[model samples]
Target: MSEQKKKIERLTGVKGMNDILPADAPLWEFFEATVRSLLKSYGYQNIRTPIVEHTQLFTRGIGEVTDIVEKEMYSFTDALNGEKLTLRPENTAAVVRASIEHNLLYDGPKRLWYVGPMFRHERPQRGRYRQFHQVGVEALGFAGPDADAEIIMMCQRLWDDLGLTGIRLEINSLGQADERAAHRRELIAYLEQHADRLDEDGKRRLHTNPLRVLDTKNPAMQELVDNAPRLLDFLGEASLAHFEGLQRLLRENNIPHKINPRLVRGLDYYNLTVFEWVTDQLGSQGTVAGGGRYDPLVEQLGGKPAPSCGWAMGVERILELLKDAQRVPEPDGCDIYVVHQGEPARIRAFIAAERLRDAGLDVILHCSADGGPASFKSQMKRADASGAAYAVIIGDDEVAADNATVKPLRGAQAGDADAAGASQQQSVAFDALAEHLIERMTA
Candidate 1:
């Protein structure tokens, strides 16, 4: 290859991964900020865990038979200790493990939220990356249907805040262990009758988790899956009551939802109340967020038996939905731009800029001294391009006079003649420019 092509190859990110450029930062910031604020209002504290954990955590917690543990985990051996570690495919197991390890449950029921990267070895596609981000909430040590209701409401609130419409909430109950065991027996027998027709993956699932056959999206498998026994039919009395209580709570809160019996989530730890938030806009991989009540996950992760229910939304998928609906907000603009014309004015601009920043205003300072008076026009243009609401013009005249011109950086004519006219310009005290910008921006 030519040297230019070789250089270009070295500049690319790995396949299935992407670098979030500056233009995309605002969307991420808005989503995270809105989630944090919403979760805070609902009394959820922030929690963070290591990015990599023992590979066995997922193997046991997410289940060895699941695609995540079996195929998608980025597992590697630690060079120093020869211990095995894997970048987390999801955060639920790690969060539960942290709660147990730290005894975070001692202070009663705990509510926590996390936002970070998650890795999975998958084909890169639109809204699906091997390295993606997730914003999730975990409510540990809570068992009642009310906890489930709270989380569903919180998820709805987040979607609404993002201006996402046409979202469908699908929920299901996987029931307790004993209930699942009975259903598993019946499901296995039913699949066995059609064993010869099963695909390779379906056959493997039949031997491991027969319930997963219902999760298949293959059109050929749909007929067989449609005839399979539904979990709702097999749920015991207690499981039935739990499902009813959740539905009742959702009804009381006026949250519209439909009960989907086939959403047995791609994990073994999930028990009861498996739900997903899907949007029709995104074609095949439409699931934006999905999780369920994992009462056994904490215990499986070496923590004391603590019932927990939570959900994790893929940031990539959510962003796709926003983009499809044209709902993503415009990038934020700077509040004020400080333009200087001379060396003394540049120095004063630097000092004044710091003061404005310390006073909680977003200020951008143009400190070049070579531009002279002619540079003021270009500086003004820069200020306009920065999306600043106001521009502070500082020159030798203003610095010597201990005054500044606070011009509303809008309604500018083509030439400086209109801008230079005293009748068109507004002069404010040099020290009060920050307050003036704040008042104007706020107004």
Candidate 2:
């Protein structure tokens, strides 16, 4: 192989994909941890499914005409066998596939949640990546507007807890399949009247999925789209009642929302209530999370008929908003840094580090040796950079004496010699190190 080609191949990641470096991980952890706790409190049991699924799952689940299955999915055939597999474009299909294959709905309702990477071949931009992460929640069975409202409420709680502002809740109902079919015929007829003004993408979807045409971003087609037959106006008795019940529930609970007639889920399976959480803070791409009822997906995926409603939030986009709003906190690092000089001190430091770990403290052992122990000044610098609360300094004299120097690194408690402005050191016996750290950290 050419050296140039080999070097190029080794140095770069796939375009549009990204790595979450150490500094970026704390925000991700905070978001994931918060979502986990929220989901757990709402009685959601997490279910993990494969990243690769049969190609038909998405085609049949998300619809072949939708942008996901049509243009953006990453699908390929296995070399060993000819079976086609796809890196999931979105996880709803896979989640539903798993639920059906396992007969999760056989007995009754199941509230499930999952968080993972999803693949989509797309132009990368702010808040958008080819390989992105999402948090998906599916409340299978218990078909009611209550399920829809519950998911919305959970999303609200998440934003409130995260201290997010300017995130708007916009909702609409796609009605039932029959209502949508009727709407489609009317929408297509209306679009045909102004086909010359429709954008290329809009015209392409005119017949295949006319509802998405109403969701156009083209300025030239705004008037045309705005005047297009509204889906909300076509809702029948049951669909109207369901949407009304959802609105009533939200109002009773004091959750604010705007009825966006133009709002429609990109997925073909959605029916009844569809909602999106949007914010103007993120330029152009304003949607942070969205989903709606997909009642027939369970049966469509080869399981007995079941009604399901769910939503998925883009982790990157939400984090982007949090970052733009300056809400992401710096990651907390080790609780203690273990620094030692000389052989006896090194050995004692290792043992003490292990003890600290066993006591549930995070410790960064000053491990590199360029010929001898790192200088005390250098070790202290590393401890500060580690964001640690304390540094445990052991030297030959202290090791021989069975004692160590405990130094405060940051966030000094009042009245301590270090509290007013500077760090201070206190002598601590070897055995009391763990207890001292625990007490100090807790304080």
Candidate 3:
């Protein structure tokens, strides 16, 4: 007897990583297209950077004490040359790195944006994932608060365009390094007094990153954090002016916001203006988007001092809100599905599909798994399932006459109530098929 074959185990995706399947692709496309158009209207151009970068870039840029660098970065040493590399956890550092390397600021300031995936190893939940996508906007070489207000206003415009509600803005000022230093000293002293109330993460970050501890999520430590010395109290003349300037711009634009003194962003590079767009819809992941000014980051990353402001919004979180708000567009499918049977009919169908496509129509040509044509009934079933507005049916008889049967698969054609029910079909010559479909669809 032949030896029994072994069964192979099924493979699954990484725990926190997820896939965006075909059924959900339309919503993703809609969201991305809306963002693209809105950014363009404001004169922002697109920029893409490598997903992998030298691990040290983030370590020194985002700060080693932060949760992302300390615990979440996906870092590995190259087996080929032993160079340490990391899949970017967040994109701000990478964006700055790219700008410096390319000398993009040589001409002048730039309004740029990026949309891509970011990696971090964390427990995935409702709105959070290990491999998530972000839409980021950066204004480089702008020193004034106008750039800050511009990016914030850009985010507000996006929210309105996407029809999302219940999201509120909160702003704060981190001041300059010296101002934060003074507050850091006082913050450490205060937290140390109530060290017993500090969570493990808070205790560990007490001296190294005291400002972050104020932004903690521990319910038990809320009281201790709220009473800790506020960073705004430590801002000097220049820093306070910048902060107030941003607020005045927001007010003139009628953007409603509150000052959250504890709004120190996660990265170490941020200074001066900081803000977050929060919502109650997504539990625990209430912060859908957040960012701030990181004027010193270019210099910190070995480039000449250049001021920059930017923000990143989580794609999954925004998509979830879109679905929750029922604002998703209809699923994207072909405008026409070509269903045919018989070897000769299939060949004719392929030709017809190409002709229709050449007319700027979206078309799907049917096929069978075993290279033999499926029954007309089976192909029609698929045509209906494709969400196609119409199906072009062909068979041996139609192929002989060089004609195709055009059947409505969706909504009723003008003056024909039963057309959507597939009760209406007409034979059209192959040459005039494209125009015929166009006229009927328009009707």
Q: Pick the candidate with the highest TM-score.
A: 3
Report the C-alpha displacement of residue 56, candidate 3, in angstroms.
Answer: 1.1
lDDT of 1 by residue, 352-431 (tens): 88988988988888744564454787888888888876788889899988878877765442123454464345677877
The candidate 2 region of ten consecutive residues with least summed lDDT is 412-421
TM-score of candidate 3 against the unseen true structure: 0.96
Q: For model 3, what is the alpha-carbon lDDT of residue 203? A: 83
If scored against the real structure, what TM-score would every candidate get? 0.91, 0.94, 0.96
Taking the candidates one at a time, how many backbone clashes does each contain?
0, 0, 0
Candidate number achieving the greatest lDDT relative to the actual structure: 3
Predicted candidate 2 versus true structure: per-residue lDDT over 264-289, tens digit per residue: 98898899999999988888889999
* Per-residue lDDT of candidate 3, residues 84-175 (tens digit): 99999999999889999999999999888999999999789987999999999989999999999999999999999999899999999999
RMSD, candidate 3, Å: 2.0
How high is the CA lDDT of each candidate model?
0.86, 0.90, 0.92
